[model samples]
Target: MKKDIHIPVVEDVYIAIVNEYNAIYKTQDWNAYIINNKAVDLELVLIVTSGYSKKKATSVFRKKLDKLPKQSYAKIELMQEELFALNNTFKVTFFEGNQMFDKTYLFRENTINLKALQSIPLMAVKGVLAK
Candidate 1:
């Protein structure tokens, strides 16, 4: 990974969004997952911990920002480091509301699904969770 890629360890991430999340990352966190956004096709992915639902995560982040962002926000990106690493491969759901129009995708080793990604508008990727 490149030094300026923004993939800081979880602790460094805490320092950035702590006050807003009661020091919890799941509520608000993220950094570039690849050495360069282009490395992952400029896709800013986050590895996240399980247990919390997307709705809960979105609500907390909105409350912290003091306003709701119309488009999805890349909140709570999972940490990738010795102390806090997430799954190397995972899936994300894309949609325009009541409909889950497409199938899930699998991502691994900094590689993502271009086909599935193309289906999602960049603005709608926020609050997405990978499992």
Candidate 2:
């Protein structure tokens, strides 16, 4: 059942395990195929909720669960999507899993670099003419 698998989503982050081997390992299975990354017939099936930018999602293991409304689910339709949502989602897992589950490491200062999406104006200026 889909509900058996817990997918965590925050804001615009969306992630999923695509490579069959990684997916198996992620779901807590220790199969040989996953142990050695030996799956040669698998394709990446990353699904995400809308609002995720293409550049921010890029990772093989981490994924974002797309923002689902209260008591609801998300709908994914794009076929050739990018990986930004996945990367952002993975970053969260990386931080959370380290802080809560792994008790081997100590706390340290974490710094983040914020990046803003850029856009160019396409329409002609009203007062200035191109020379």
Candidate 3:
């Protein structure tokens, strides 16, 4: 008789937050905040995608975090134009212990709070602006 091997899946170890940052100069930017809620460190890769056509999707941004400590978070920023053009979706892949995990989040999902983004602090400018 042949036996089947099974692996357990972990749930809710990481959380993602999407928000908008209004710059001091009247410009706006979008940000994705990845928070690790697990007790151990993690290695993560973040990919942003958007619908390119009726049947196809395209990647707009890619970032990798070699190590995200437990209970820590990382912020990834995007320009307003890019966020609007890309339609704002995220695919996050991470490694915890010996297992790998992956999940996708859409902009319209309830997990992402767009209204809270407005309360985020604005980006500060350190240099003078040119006319």
Measured by TM-score, the strongest candidate is 3
Clash count, one per candidate: 4, 11, 0
Model 1, range 10-68, lDDT digits (tens) per residue? 11111111112226535633332211111112122323222223232221111122222
TM-score for each prediction? Answer: 0.24, 0.15, 0.57
- Single out the weakest 10-residue window by summed lDDT for candidate 1: 10-19
User: lDDT at 24 for candidate 1?
Assistant: 56
Candidate 3: tens digits of C-alpha lDDT, residues 72-109: 66775543433343335666777888778777655542
List the candidate 2 regions with Cα displacement exceeding 4 Å: 12-93, 98-131
Could you list the CA RMSD of all candidates, in the order they appear?
16.6, 21.0, 8.7
Candidate 2, residue 113: how far the Cα is off, in Å: 18
Clashing pairs in 3: none
Q: What is the lDDT of candidate 3?
A: 0.51
lDDT of 3 at 33: 63
> Residue 39 CA error for candidate 3 (Å)?
1.2
Model 3 Cα displacement at 70 (Å)?
Answer: 0.4
Looking at model 2, residue 26 earns an lDDT score of: 58
Positional deviation of residue 74's Cα in model 3 after best superposition, in angstroms: 0.5
